[model samples]
Target: MSVIVGVATLTVVATGFSPHTAERETVHWSYQGSTGPEHWAGLSEDFAACGAGREQSPIDLPEDTAVGTSSDEAITIDYHPVTAKLVNNGHTVQANVSPGSRIIIDGTPYELQQFHFHLPSEHTEDGEHTAMEMHFVHADEAGDLAVVGVLMEKERGDSAFTDLWDRLPTEEGDEAQINEPFDLAEFLPNDRDQYQYDGSLTTPPCTEGLKWIVLDDPVSVTPSQVAAYREVFHRSNRPTQPLNDRVLTLVED
Candidate 1:
């Protein structure tokens, strides 16, 4: 049997049929069961690449990899909460972002589009599971993607996420305000040390060329927050893919 890979950009078109604009790309994707990661390539012509990508994402980091900070290329993100709309596209829980939000990575500005939740966390530490994970997806001026991951663990009491948890849309396609602005800057850790590498998207049609930065510090979130995410995606994470000789860089804050 020969391994086949298909892929397509998530570009959206404003007219006719595509929701994405000429500059924007939208992807058709799915997760779990027969249609899970294993079937992504066969399911769609655009997703064939998912099955044959050289650099995939969500790798389990070895516990004793001398994790620390060094370089100063640290990026700063300044995000404000807005009336985000929740859209369950049969993959993971995703949000349709409002306007007026942007993320700065090492001074390079990227516009915030939408974000989504992943459970049991996607990236792992020494194969250990973090309670939850939130992916704040951003795109640069050229439409390139740079995803900033904030890992979540059990906390003693309420944290900033409680506000988000309370406001998370229950049904797919439901939209709501957080009762306040959602700032992306506040959600980031003080130490900007991260593991940077070239990787593909975790979801179907799992496109490559994304600049992946997995933060070292795991943020705190109430158990309720974890449970809230579980309600939507219980162990919805795709299994950790192979490294394939990719160089994982540990940068300074």
Candidate 2:
């Protein structure tokens, strides 16, 4: 079962925020070419679970499932935009976040630890694809998982994006933080309609038991932003998997 929540927005834009010192930590990644998603778990010992997990994300949604109750959850999210730095992971270019944001879903609140982007979209509908998508990863006090996805399309006059994209970090392991607060509501579509389902993570350690919500409407970005993103991540979306008889609900007004 699932529930959808909605909110209003202020004239929010993404731009030069602030830059932070790169916290040195030992971590593994599944990037493109040599270390892509297909070989994430194999790349490092920390990601063994990613390869052997039952539920994974980016599965193709089949048009059939046993109907059940629609979700009625109300979510409250707290996100601050800092300087967002882009890195060309082997799989794609990603904008990594500082660890202080959070999201509340269905009366349950989760912290927004980090976020990333995907090109051509990892998730699809009826075999159709969106131009780009963003994933805000959150976790609750108990470590449960929920994701907030914002989809993007080609348009014009996105100055916030222009500022951010213009100064993206060209190489991996490089980061900059923006000190300004980025209201997540700005990225949301005016319409609150969404789709809810059960799924897993698209990356390695493909853990299951995730609450997946994808907004039906997509926000606009300038062609230059899209072009810049392509230059970094020509393609990083995971191939959609079989739905395995799962249910998907379209939240309607």
Model 2 ranges with Cα > 4 A deviation: 1-54, 61-71, 74-101, 157-160
Per-residue lDDT of 204-227 in model 2, one digit per residue for the tens? 445578887776677787777877
Candidate no. 2 TM-score: 0.72
Q: Candidates' TM-scores?
A: 0.81, 0.72
Candidate with the greatest TM-score versus the true structure: 1
Per-residue alpha-carbon lDDT of candidate 1 for residues 1-253, written as tens digits (9 for 90 to 100): 1111222233331101111235533443334555566776876676676788888877876635634556666666667767665555334556667777876766778887777767778898888878878787778877777777778777877577766666666654456654345676666677766777778777755677877777888888888777777776555677788888887777666
Each prediction's RMSD over C-alphas, in Å, is 6.2, 9.7
Query: Could you tally the backbone clashes for each prediction?
Result: 24, 27
For residue 98, model 2's alpha carbon misses the true position, in angstroms, by: 5.7
Error of 1 at 62 (Å): 3.0
- Residue 176 lDDT in candidate 2: 55
Query: What value does the lDDT take at residue 213 in candidate 1?
Result: 79
